[model samples]
Target: MKELIISSINDNLNNAVALLDAIDSKTYSDDSIGPYYSSIGSHIRHTLDFFDCIISGIDTNDIDLTARKRDEILSTNKEAAKSHIHTLQGTLLSYIDANTDYLIHVTDNMGQGKVTVNYTLESILAHANSHAIHHYATIGYILNQLGIDLKIPGFGYNPTTPVNKREGI
Candidate 1:
């Protein structure tokens, strides 16, 4: 189960990297719907931190999230921040694989009974991948609003293209 989860998420994360790579660095600063919407950089960071917080079961300890200022959340240096964003998803996969046998039942921030029934290792992994894909779409929307054409990294089909296979060059 863990293997399946890891493989699935790894694929999504890799595709996400491909999509991020398609985006020019300048678009990182492009604003979304509102000032509080957070630029692309913030979206990238939020993608990782939010998932890690949920999975790690230590969500409240995340200081960055407490920031009400949009600038603070979105101000991470472009190249370095993107690199970290790509790395985190892979690490999450590894973490889940290593701890597959153990069940993780974490409550959400609202203290709601958000039971994570990790009956199969794949369950958590699938959730994370789906979570990331939704965020990736946000990345696209931001790029679209910026009017920056999304470059498909290669001569053939790219990660940004809608397709079944998530990863491409």
Candidate 2:
């Protein structure tokens, strides 16, 4: 289970890496296209921030989803975003042998107010993976608006989602 989870997360992160490699800096930081006007780099940074939170609090067993870095450089620089993803991938690899079932406290605001809840390490990782995929889908939309084609297959789709139903396929 641990191996599978790590593999899935790594695969998703690799998609980000591939995108960073394919696009130019201008396209990465371009926010001119969209109703929300969010850049592809911003989505990548936001997705990485979720994993950063996990890495930050995992040692203490207290994860705070709101404690994001939100670094402007990461939001606009493809190189910085790629480096951040690489660091996260290494950190996750180090935890491959750790106990996945260990309980941890996660704090996040789910509309009303901030709340802390118990979650297994595996569960939180799964959540983060899903969160990353969600952001990737948004990034895909931005890419489409920019006329950029993603070379990675299933880059912005959940594993369970049907290929025919995927947006911008």
Candidate 3:
């Protein structure tokens, strides 16, 4: 189970890595898109931040999802984003076959106020996987606006999505 969970997390993280490698710095940092005005780098950084929080809290068993590094370099520099991706991938490798039964205290806001909920390591990993997929979809849109083709089929589609309906299908 731990191996499967780690693999799932790494899959999405790898997708971000591939994207960072494919785009230039200008495309990465561009926030000129209307409506939200967010860049692909922003989405990548935000997606990785959740994994960062989870990994940083592993030793203490206290994960704070609301607390993020928000590193500017990650949201601007393509190389920096790629480096962070490598770091996260390596960090996740260490957790393969780890004890997923350990209890993890997750801290996050739920409309009313901040809440600390208990979850198994596996469960939190699952949530992080889903979170990454959601952010990747947004990044895909950003890439589309910039006219940058990642050429990665199903880059942002859910695994269970019908094959014919997928973006790159």
TM-score of every candidate relative to the true structure: 0.62, 0.94, 0.93
Query: Among these predicted structures, which one has the highest lDDT?
Result: 2
CA lDDT of every candidate = 0.54, 0.88, 0.83
Off by over 4 Å in 2: 166-169
Between prediction 1 and prediction 2, the one with superior lDDT is 2
Pairs with backbone N, CA or C atoms under 3 Å apart (clashes), candidate 3: none
- TM-score winner between 1 and 3, please give it: 3
* Cα RMSD to the true fold for all candidates: 6.1, 1.5, 1.5
For model 1, residues 1-169, the per-residue Cα lDDT tens digits are 5666666666655655665566666666566555467677777666566555554552232222222233343345566655665666566655653644545543333356333333233454455566666766666666666676665432123335667553322
2 against 3, candidate with superior TM-score: 2
- Pick out the ten consecutive residues of candidate 1 with the lowest summed lDDT: 59-68
Report the C-alpha lDDT of model 2 over 1-169, residue by residue, as the tens digit. Answer: 8778988899889988988998999999999986999998889889888999999999999899989988889988899889988989989988889876778999999999999999988889899999989988888888888877766788888989897766432
lDDT of 1: 0.54
Q: lDDT per residue, candidate 3, 51-121, as tens digits?
A: 89999888898899889999988899889888888888888889886766667899998988899999988
